[model samples]
Target: MSAHEDVGELVPEGTFLRPDDSVRRFAGGTVLVGGSPLWLLKLGAQGARVFGRWVNGGEALRRNAGEQRLARRLLDAGLLHPESPRGRFTLADLTLVTPVKDNASGVHRLLEATDELSERIIVDDGSVEPLPEAALRHEKPLGPAAARNAGWQRVRTELIAFVDSDVVPETGWLDAILPLFSDPEVAAVAPRIRSRPGDAPLERYEQDRSALDLGSRPAPVRPMSRVSYVPGAALVVRRSALAELGGFDTRLRFGEDVDLVWRLAASGHTVRYAPESVVWHDPRAGLLEWMRQRFEYGTSAASLSARHPGLLCCAKVSRWSALSWGLLASGRPVTALATAAVTTALFPRALRGRGIPATEALRLAGVGHLGAGRILAEATRRTWWPPALVAALFGGRARAVTSAVLLPCLIESAGKGPSWALLRLLDDLSYGAGVWAGCLKERTIGPLRPQFTDDSLCRGSGRRLPASRSIGSKAGRTCDRSRSSQRYERVGAR
Candidate 1:
């Protein structure tokens, strides 16, 4: 029934919980069953949390028979063995919540792994076609926020692990995570993610760089320190933690995890990074997709900055650069020249201490400028349809006027100061796209069926990640063999 009473019955006493459970406690406070750190009470709290509004975030995944079975099994196990050291756990299912326009190759592997988990789910988040025979539960067409909320509502276990469909877990992934709940205070757990191979070189490089950059950051175990945002790709959260925060903010299109962590920290919860838990992701490939994603990110960042002024300075550069590029892309030679000159003048500030390859960084800067230009061009066209359309289709007087009015100002501003402005701009755009796409039917467009044939994305096709043996052996246990060169042709054979 009630959480406290339910938890009180599980741990009668005298249980040595796993190491992670001991290490993850919130501010060194232990989780108790019958009012002390034990397995039963922990399990009970986990179960109660899974069925309520808190578990709504994971509804889609739990709606599928296969996924639901997994959830049921995990919940059943928790209910039966409330104090067992190995049995205490929760399931946080992650849904990508992106349009079906593109299929990340690693999705199958994620599904494959989910089948093995004690509690597994793949929330479709209103995709064009229900995830290839997986049949994720459908909910109203809401964005990521609602999808996550639905998921949280379906939780039937003590811990909820959110793993994106695009991310494949390494063998023993959960082996490294579940025990952390033994500590009552540890509210959340995040795993390390590496980019899967077989992705485009640029995509791989970006993913690797991001993993390296974010992976090294410290995880906050203290109530006072803000936990680094639990990446949505692979995060394990306690049911109690989810309830405490009241689930993800349905309003945020981007940085929802960051906001969640900020709130959790503000509410005095502990979050830890379990490096032992590994997930592989192959991020989007192609320059256009990358740029689009980044631009959307910039919009979200701007929204965030508007609310949190600390982000304003960082976000300004991207916005300014985008608007400037919009001007230059038009036939505004004078403005382009002035902006270029001003941008060149500001080169010193932009270049300071950045370790990224000079060429690559410059390329990104150029893209940012071009994206801003595109946005401004779109705005202009939307406002004055005929002239803007003509100017867009064929260079015209208005194009020159736009460049003249905006270019000099942009170039001058860029030259005067270097802010992490480009990054902010990209963040805003990516986030904005995510939000905007949520509303448009065209955004959900995907192939009538998977475009890539089995042969196309299989091992010999050069789109596979390295494969390894399962960490432990069990009858009928499956490993995602698609990426293994040895088993390439054998996919679907078993």
Candidate 2:
């Protein structure tokens, strides 16, 4: 079939719509049959405000390129403003721009994220199924990057927020972090990730660790050079700034988030973590699934280290050392025997007390250990980020520690799966580990230093500060004059 033939459907008849902001006419001819609704929007180059539709369908294309359905209509419409004053973007929530796919639970979670975003658009990433009550916006199989670009181009808002398909935004997320953009120098902000409740123990543990890394607690403030990459699960980026950075690196299979952050930093733009902007992700439910995730993460890390050879080589060495240490520490006959016996006895407690059936708890523990090993293998394959290796090698150990700490709390949460207990342990251990590791690294290189002393995080605050400057604050913020004052713009033909 011709590429354009894959345009599954067209806009609905007499679609009820409104014309606000940059749009002059709600044209019906711009849509295709069997595709999603198409609202051809217009955004003036300057002085814009928010403009978009809460669209649904099998995904809609901005413009057709005959046989090339994936062609970028938005990018082709405008020239890059390379010299535009680049700033970071901050999103209050995830913007899921894909066709509705099966996996009911997954879709429900996506819907949760959609509710979180101040604005959201579902591009219908070309679904074969009939459109739901929510029409698809675009139907062509534009790769995510192309769709994202097209979506941004259609955005009348000053910023673009991106969220993954499987993530669910937490409550009070947007209101907590939306004001951080007052600085304008802050171009982007990524959210903290937690585990979805009702999943298996291992999944819960994985999410706990992820959330602790980016939560509201005081994190170590190292030189900007010391900061690592951000995850894209829930990232808000400035539209103009991302356009300047060339949007998402479509070429990457993984590390796209890292690549984007690295490029933003290199360009002298600031990328911050909005701890209050939180999303809970559903981690792989079983041990084998977790292993698959670790392998992919390892492969991505290896490739990343190879590219940044100087900075990453130490991480590689650290990985090997940590692995050897883990095996030596845990695989000792005495230790292994003790762990086996303890683990065996604990199975009953886990079943009765932790709400996990005895069979499932034991099964998950075994898988969790195996998954940790896979993460270790991933670390060894990488050249740097040795701590991550340690995390992998001993992740099961951490899980064991976390679970031990959680048993009481699980019993206390009254069958809540010890999520709170797990979170507390992770907060103390995982985040504490990052802070300690960063500090140790600094001690070797020198004292931990600030990347931008003039920025709010480091300047004269006697008390520990939150990671985000404006998240969760109740008062209106004083706008900084050194940056742009543009608001969300309307995008359509006026």
Candidate 3:
């Protein structure tokens, strides 16, 4: 397949370079991507000239052999934007399901929010106050996973829409996302779960940084892609796929959504995240409950790690970001500046897989590490961050440290004060603590182990990387970096 075949057109985080940006003149033209080296293009004389023209003229492409080659390379690198294909699928074929417990008001709000659906199933998982008569009541609480399975069994449509009662889906969510199932391999598609209105700082902080909200980027949902697991809160799934997989493992009360998605990918199916499909979720307004919810969400990670091992380890640290933060926290301002050097060097290293080009692999590495790093970072919360925060603040590197840690939070905080950012730190600590708790309960450190492809094992075995990255480019056919590559580790049972 060509580079454009599976590339999503919308890259929310603007590439390191774009059609419009201030050009910095130097001895040679150089453009860094995500602060890494120019993986978008080789930045040779010809490529640099083409990029300069596009940058100055606000053009994403030019029609010519050399320019087209560079453009395809850029597209493969996720720098050039492709046209996002419009989805076309009938809503009538979809069924909406949400598992609820003591969320009558949330359920009511959802009723109004997703009025477009004709068949909506609200499986009442033993609500305390007793849900309204309109709900499909289950006498006993079977947990969210089981509750979802109960509802899906009744669906006759090709697709099922699962929305958490706590969230209110914005208009056009179904329209924007349901079409994703047009691809037979796609088992499910999840929307962007935005934070609902909250009166307190913690709630406000979650608005910009809700644990459920994957940033606004549309990508295939896989074990470690832009979206690993779509939250159980909301999803549009193909009915037959769920049935074939025995629905969700009804035994899992928590992280069932994760289990389902990972299972789908594991079984050679596709899942996706559509940021345009917005679902506003009302996160906990109180601190105690908020922390508890985070803790609960974390317990699910240990469970997921056992089921999906390689995805949750520190080795999945896809980006060089935490490294910079580490140096800053160590009171080594002089060293933090070298982060760019460290990151640029690793840019080519993530490219070592058989079929994936260096540039595309780097992007995928960012996504994989991002998904993996969250788990790894949370695991470290118990031992790091707190002391690092103190040392940075008191050790006279507050300005640099703050920028490194909370710069991204600033956008999500939506102008909330430092308390919001502080709460984020506490949130990680809470989740990290939960991982330890889960490990204790499970009686294994399997939750903390890292797994990656050792090409040496595959070489003599004549095995290949998973089907996802199995497609090789002509030029990349000879590209071999298993010795140097760290990302694009093969998936499936060891």
Q: For residues 165-264, could you state the per-residue lDDT of candidate 2 as single tens digits?
A: 6777776665544554544445676677776765556655665444224544311111222235567767777777887978876655555667677677
Top candidate (TM-score): 3
Error of 3 at 203 (Å): 2.1
For each candidate, give its TM-score against the true structure.
Answer: 0.44, 0.44, 0.66
RMSD score of candidate 3 (Å): 9.3
Instruction: Please give the lDDT score at residue 274 for candidate 2.
Output: 50
lDDT of 3 by residue, 225-273 (tens): 4456788888888889989899888766678888888888777675666
How far out, in Å, is residue 383 in model 1? 27
TM-score, prediction 2: 0.44
Error of 2 at 434 (Å): 22
Error of 3 at 24 (Å): 17
- Per-residue lDDT value at 456 in model 2: 17
Error of 2 at 235 (Å): 0.7
Q: After superposition, how far is residue 225 of candidate 2 from its true place, in Å?
A: 6.2
